[model samples]
Target: MSFKTILAVVTDQAHMSDTLAQAVTMADALDAHLSVVCIGVDRTQTGYYYAGMNAAVLQETMNHAREQAAELATAAKKQMEMSGLRWGVSEAVCQLADMSRYVAAHARFADLAILPRPYGDDRGIELEAATEGALFEGQSPVIVLPEGGAELKMPQKIAVGWNESAEALRAVRSALPFLIAAQSVHIVVIDPPKHGPNRSDPGGQLSQYLARHGVKVEIDVLSKTMPRVSDVMRRHVSDMNADLVVMGAYGHSRFREAILGGATRNMLETSEVPVFMAH
Candidate 1:
């Protein structure tokens, strides 16, 4: 019911400091153990470009990646040493193809995973892979920080983006700890179906469920003013001044979301507030 363990995945050095600060702050706030995984991605794979290249090129690339990963791990450990929280740091030097697997191995052990938003211009391929690994392979809820990293506050006002899908149900369950602790929780449903269980009352069933868990919630049944569902959800979160948003990731398949563009993909790319997601 509570987060006792948290995993933070970091790759590039540019985001290391901010990402670690965010992770440490959350861990301190929740009294949870922090696990830092620093990955130095080796994109130099054996392919057509390297078909005629020397073996030394591959060896050198790998050694450089390991060195970088070790340095990042050392820096992270040094920072966390004075954090006064139970923490550990590990480094991985892996090829791009193997990044997700490595991330999943560590993410599976934690109650929740913290990640930097992997959609901006500065984002790396490894970060995107790590996110997919945590959500799909690790089967853990993830809190993705904004581009510049937000002031890691304990979520006082939380917003839930609801639809009648199993993914949404699972997301609500995963975010129970935060919802229980928040001062106010809002369940926002945009153009809910008129024939489902909640036909007469869109968010009534969910409100009752949360009430049993000692969470008072308000329901907002909104008509989508913008073209995309994500647009309406984003505006609602901003207007409510919610510090955090909880929603299911990729109600459709990942491939479909990537190609056809769904709400989950849009939110990931543009939400200013931290997004808590699970799939």
Candidate 2:
């Protein structure tokens, strides 16, 4: 499906430029509306329970955060205009207690959300939570950019992390727009240990399926040495210099990710390129 509105979640962290650039590029390509969200802390509410800081100090802190958020939105708007893409800028005052919830609420109005992967020493937990919120709560497809990667083009080479699971199949179907646009596509079947009786070769099946849809396709079986499916898929992207990776989001509980931490989260944290994820 074509995306008409794209939401990008930005914060005071590293890799903001890359994330902004990617968002602008996608908006330009799709001629879509872009929304840049800056998540910040609200210290006013925190002062009610804390004894160390007073109302005046908390207000000062919140004021500073608001200034920073405005600056970030301004810079992102400038970048989008520089790229010749028309976009609208938006800012929200959020409390840490419900920041993810706020993001999810805003996402309800957009077609997609672009987020940065979890990395570095300090912001790892926050990134993880935000990404989880985007995937589980937003209930929309998310595009995650790597930590320090270059901007992605039209994704000439695309990799789909395929399994027999319903989620993986849904992701593949949701990514059809990109697949149709990509010059080359690879369907990677991540087989489970101790193959079962009904475990048909997904790679071959998917290749044949896409060929009918006019996508130039290839299949590759990962070696046994590469155990976890997510890790192997990421390694393939790096080795092949793929521009985009597509996979499914897996979550067992509201607060927990399932086995392998889900392909979406794994590639987001470790990939060297862009990843398109859907639940």
Candidate 3:
């Protein structure tokens, strides 16, 4: 029902600032074990296996990278020792050029995963490798931290961006542990469908569902005239003074009449609050 084991990813030294610190704080609060995985260079990515490359040069390059990664991992382990929480540190390398899957595999057993949210212009390969692995591949809920990092506040008022999609449903399900304990939960739906029970009342089904789970639920709907789902959700969260936003992470597709990536990406980039996502 609560997070017992948390996986905090460290892409490099920067991860210490952007992710590991937050993970350590949360782990301390939850009395959980924090596992830090430091990623090493992928031989395939550096073109180290190619024929033209000098064998000595490749050896030197790999050795230097290994040394740097090892030192960073060591530093992280030292810090974790002072975190006052059960903790462990390990290292991994990208295999088959699929860092995302590799990263997700590392976090598969964790109760929760925390990773950085890269801005639109900053969508580098490393970002996807670090995030998508857990968000898409792992079963755990992922908390995407804001750029430059933000404190994982004691969530009092939580906001849910509702869109009747599989992804949204998964997000809601993954967030049940948090929702059940929240002081207030707002299911904000932008232009809910006008059909069946929705025509008579939107958010009725979901409200009833959460109510059964002992959550104090509120359904806030915005008109279709609203500019965008992400924009309106932000305004509503600000109005509600919510500390966290819960929503589906990349489950919608073009076939679903919604681009799953669009709204999710927007929230990831623009929200000052942490976004909890599940696919």
Candidate 4:
């Protein structure tokens, strides 16, 4: 019912600071152990690698990455030790293709996984692969942070992106702890699925369900004028000053390559706040 062991991915230099801030806060709040996984690897072994960089250049590039990883690991270790919370780090130097599997193998046992949003950019395919692998290859829910940054709080305001799919149901279940603790919970229905909220039967009894669990629930039906409703959801969350967005990740994947749904894809690309996702 509580997050007791939180696993955070700490690659992606752009996302490093944000990861530590949120991970440490979550760990401190829950009296949990924060395990940091910094995936540093030689992509040359896998035939394809970082865009435009050859093996010789990549070796130098990864040397810089490794140095930064070491600095981060040292800082995390010291901070956790001072905070009186248990922590560990894994700087797994391995093949690029195996990175996702490496992360999932370790992440499956944790209560929650924290990750950076996977970008299909020239240099970020591995991060996306790891995130995708975690979503489908593990049971735990993942909280993905946008590149800008985020801090974990007591989650005073929370928004649930509503849909009727099994993934949505799983996401609601996954977010129980946060919902049970929030000051206000919004069931945001945008372009609902077939069995979702409607004019007369708004929220399809989910509001009642959450209310039964002592959650302060409200249902809102938002009309979407854009193709990507995820953008709308993020806007709503920001408008509500919600700290967390709970939703299902709807997507198709092959060879660790994911073709996400519009809402899911947009959220990954442009979330201003932390997002809890399950699939």
Clash totals in order: 0, 0, 0, 0
The TM-score, computed over Cα atoms with residue i paired to residue i, of candidate 4 is: 0.84
Better of 3 and 4 by TM-score: 3
> Candidate 1 vs candidate 2: which has greater lDDT?
1
Q: Write the per-residue lDDT of candidate 1 for residues 35-137, one digit (tens) a residue.
A: 9998888988535355577878878888999998999999999999989999999998989988888898888989999999978778887888899999999
In candidate 3, how many Å is residue 131 off? 1.4
What C-alpha lDDT does candidate 3 achieve relative to the native structure? 0.77
Q: After superposition, how far is residue 172 of candidate 3 from its true place, in Å?
A: 1.3
lDDT of 2: 0.73
What TM-score would you give candidate 3 relative to the actual structure? 0.88
Error of 4 at 53 (Å): 14
TM-score computed on alpha carbons, candidate 2: 0.86
TM-score each candidate.
0.97, 0.86, 0.88, 0.84
lDDT tens digits by residue: candidate 4, 1-279:
888899987665566766777788888887888888877654555555667777689678678667756766766566556656688877756466777788888779898888877764524667776776677776778988766655676577899998666878789888888899899999998875555245467686888888898999998888886666777888888888888889988644442324435677778777878889898
| Model 2 per-residue lDDT at 144 | 81
Task: Put down candidate 2 lDDT per residue, 113-227, tens digits, no spaces.
Answer: 8887755454535566567667668777888887677775567899888766676677777777778888999887665435675355546667777788788888876664565
Off by over 4 Å in 2: 43-48, 122-125, 192-198, 251-264
Model 3 stretches with alpha carbons more than 4 Å out:
43-52, 120-123, 224-226, 253-261
Clashing pairs in 2: none
- All candidates' lDDT scores? 0.90, 0.73, 0.77, 0.77
Error of 2 at 194 (Å): 4.8
Question: What is the per-residue lDDT of model 3 for residues 227-271, given as tens digits with 9 covering 90 to 100?
Answer: 667788877777787888999876555234223347777788788
